[model samples]
Target chain A: MSLLKEFKVLAFLVVLVTGAVLVYAIGDFPDWGDPISPASEHVSSYYIENAIHDTAVPNIVTALLADYRGFDTMFETVVVFVAGIAVLFMLRRPKRESEVSMDVSGSPIVKTATRIMVPMMQLFALYIVAHGHHSPGGGFQGGVILGASLILMAIAFGLPSALKKISNKATVMLSALGVLIFSGIGILCMFLGGNFLDYSVLSAILPGTDRVMARSHAMLGVEIGVALTVMTAMFSIYADLASEGQLDQGL
Target chain B: MIWQFDIIILTLVIVSALSALRIRDLLGSAIIFGVYSFLMCLLWAGMGAVDVAFTEATVGAGISTVLILATVLHTKRRTKD
Candidate 1:
C-alpha cells in the first residue's frame, strides 16, 4: 500500500478507538459546569472562595500560583532557569572561526504571515499573564504561549532573526531576574514579620485599603516574573533544537 | 449517544497509540502523537475534566507537538530499529 493510504487507514482506526474510550469514560462523568464535579469538590473550591479574600485577587488561579502555593511557583521558576542554562551549555560552541549565518530561505507569503502573527501572539501572551488575576490562566500557560510565539518567529523568519530578538544572554538574565523578583517578594514578607511569601503582612507596610491591592499587585508581579522565565527557557530549548534541524534532518 | 461518543473516542486513542509505535517514519509518528494528544484532550473534556483538558490542549497539543517537531528536524526522519 502507498504510504498515504496506510496513513489514512491508521488515522481512521485511531479515531475509532478514541471514540470508543470517550463513550465509556464519559458515562461516569458529571455534567459540564455542574460546579459539584469532582474537580470542583476536591480542591479548586477552597481556593476559589478564600483566595480572593486572603489574596485579594479576583483570579483564583493567580492566587493559587503566587500565594496558596507560592513555593511551587518558586521552584517552577528555578526549573525554567535550569533548563535555559542547560540548553545554552549544550549548544555553546567556541567562537566560530567565522560566524556561520543561520539564514532562512522561505517564501514571502510565509514570512509576511509570520511577521503579522508574531506580534499578535506576543500581545496575547502578555494579556494572558496580565489578566491571569481575573481569569482561569496564570503564569505557566501564558509563558508557554509566549515561548510558542518566539518559536513561530524562528520557523518563519530564521533562527538568526529570532536570536536577535532573544539572545541566550538576555534569556539567562531575564530568567535570573524573574527568580530574583520572586524571592524579593518573599524577602519583603519576611521583613514584615511574616513567613516567606506571607502576603498578609504586606498590608502593614501599605497605608489602608491599598494593602489588599498591594498584595494582589505583588502577586501579579511574581506571575509576570514566572511567565518571563518559563517562556524564555522553553523558547531557548526550541531554538537550539531547530537550529540543528533536529526535527527534519539527521542529528 | 454520549456513551457511543465516548466509546468512539476510546477506540481512537487505542488505535493512535498502536500506530504511533508502528509507524516507520519518525515525522509521521510525531504528527500522529500530536493527534493522539488532541484526542486525549477531547476525552478529558468529555469526562468533565475541563482543567485537565485545558492543560492537555495547551501543553500536549500545542507546545509538546512543536517541541517534538523541532527534535524531529534535528534528527533523521526514518528510524533504523
Candidate 2:
C-alpha cells in the first residue's frame, strides 16, 4: 500500500478509537443543568448570587468575565493581537506587479445593499458592546459582527476599497491599542491602590460613583478594549488570508 | 433545554460534521463546517448560553466559513488522495 494510504488508514483508526472513547465518556457526564454537578455547585453559585451586587452589572456572565476574571480576558485580547501580528509577519508581502489588476467593482445591487447594511451592522456591534452588561451579547460577539461586516464590505466592494477604509497599518495599530487599553486599565487600578484589574479601587479617583459603579464602568472599558482587538484581529486575518498577504487583491 | 430540540440539533451537528470531514470538495467542506457551527450555536442557545451561541454564530459560522472559502478559492478546490 502507498504511504499516504497507510497514513490515512492509521489516522482513521485513531479517530475511530478516540470517538468511541469520547462517546463512552459522554455517558458519565452529569445530566444537563444538574444543579448538583460540580460545575454548578461551587464558584458558579457564588458568581450567580453576588455578581450583580459586586459589579453592578445585570449580566452575570459579563461581570464574571470582565471583572471577576479580568486578568484572563486581558490575556485573551493579547492573544488575539498576537495572532494578528503573527499572520502579518508570516503572510504579508509587497504587492506583485502582475497580480495588481483585477475586477474591483461588484454588482450595484450588492454594493448598494452592503452600503446600507454596513453602517447598521457597525451600530449594532457598538450596541452589543455597550449593552453587554445588561444583555447576552458582549465584546467578543460584537467584535466578530463588526469584523464580519468589514469582511462583507470587502467581498461586495472589493478588497482595495475596504483596505482604503481600514488599512493594514490601522489594523495593526488598532489591535495593539486594544491590548494597551486593557492593560492600561489594569495598571490604573493598581495605581489606585488595588491589585491589577481590581476596578473597585478606581472609585477613589472617579468623582461621584461608588466602588460597584466603578467596577461596572471598568467592565465597559475592558469590553471596549476586547471589542477593538477582536474586530481588528478578525479583519486583519481575513484581509491577509484572502489577499494572500498581498493586501492588494480579493477572491 | 427541550429534549426534542436538543436531539434534533445534536443529530444535525453530527451529520454536518461527518459530511464536512468526508466531503472531497474543499469549498463544500468549508460550507458544511459552517452549517455544523450554526447547529452548534443553536444547541448552545437552547442550553441558554446565549453569549456562547453568539460567538459560535459570528466566529464559527460566519467568519471561519468565509475565511475557509477564500483560502479554498485561492488554492485547490478538490482534495486529492
Candidate 3:
C-alpha cells in the first residue's frame, strides 16, 4: 500500500479508538472545579490561600514554582542544563576552513509574519512568567513559549541564522547563570538565618512594608532564572537537531 | 463538561500510544508519541493537576518528541521486524 493510504488508515483507526475510549472514560471522571481532589487537599489549597500573603504574588502557580515546591524547580533547571550539554557534546563539529551555510531567504510574507510574531510571543512569555503567582501559567509554561518563539525563528530564517542570533555558548552561559543565581539566593537565605531557601529571612534586610515586597521580588528573581534556563535549553536542543538536518534528512 | 474533556483526553492517550506502537515508520511513531504526551497533558489538566500537565506538555510533548525525532533522523526510519 502507498504511504498516503497507510496514513489514512492510521488516522481512521486513531479516531475510532479515541471516540470509543472517550465514551468509556467520561463516565468515571470527577467533576471539574470540585476543589476536593488530592490537589486541593494536599498542597494546592495552602498555596492558594497563603501564597499571596507570604510571597506577595497573586499567582498560585508562581508561588508553587518558586517557593512551595522550589526544590523541584532547581532539579528541573539542572535537567535542562544537562540536556543542553548533552546536545552540544553530540553535535559539536570542528570548524572547517570553509563551512557551508544554508540559504535562509524566505518570502516577504513569511519574513514579516515572523518579525511581528517573535516580539509578541516573547512579551506574552514574560507576562505569563510575571503573573504566574495569580494565574494558570508559570515559569515552565512561559519558558516553553519563549523556546517555541526561538524555534519559530529557526523555521522562518533557517538554523544558522537563529544560531548566529543566540549562540550555543551564550545559551550554555545563560543556563549556568540561572542555576547559579537560584543557588545563590538559597545561600543568601542560609546566611540570613534560615535553612536553605527561606524567603522570610530576606525580610530582615528590608525596612517597613518593604519586607513583603522583598520576598516577592526574590521569588520573581528565581522564577526568571528558571524561565531563562529552560527557554535556552530548549532552543539549544532544536539548534542541535536543525544543524544535523535531522528533520529533513529522514535518516 | 469537565468529565467529558477528561474522557476525550484519556481516549486520545490510549489511541496515540497504540498507534505509535503499530506504525511502521519510526518518525511516525515519534510523532504519535508526541501526540500521546499532549493528550496526557490534557488528561492531567482535566483532573485539575495543572502543574503536572504543564510539565508533561513541555517535557513530554515538546522536548522528548524533538529529541526522539532527532535520534531518528540520525538513525533509521524503520525498525526491522
Evaluate all candidate structures by whole-model CA lDDT and list the values in order: 0.78, 0.91, 0.77
Q: How well does candidate 2 match the true structure in TM-score terms?
A: 0.96
Report the alpha-carbon TM-score of model 3 versus the true structure.
0.77
Error of 3 at B48 (Å): 2.6
CA displacement after TM-score superposition, residue A5 of candidate 3 (Å): 29
Model 2 misses residue A197 by how many Å?
0.2
Candidate 2's displacement at residue A26, Å, is 2.2
Error of 2 at A245 (Å): 1.1
Mind giving the per-residue lDDT tens digits that candidate 3 earns over A146-236? 9988887776787667777887679889978888888888888899988787777787875664656767777877878888888988887
Per DockQ, what order, best first?
2, 3, 1
Task: Report the number of the highest-TM-score candidate.
Answer: 2
Per-candidate clash tally: 39, 0, 5
Pairs clashing within candidate 3: A58-A133, A58-A134, A59-A133, A59-A134, A60-A133
Query: Cα lDDT of model 3 overall?
Result: 0.77
Candidate 1 per-residue lDDT, tens place, A1-251, comes to 59989999999999999999998998899886678888889788788667777767876656776887898989988987897788777875554445455456467998899888888988988887888778666677788888888787777776766777777678778878878888888899899898998777777776664656767877877888888888888887786676652222111
Pairs that collide in candidate 2 are none
lDDT of 3 at A171: 82
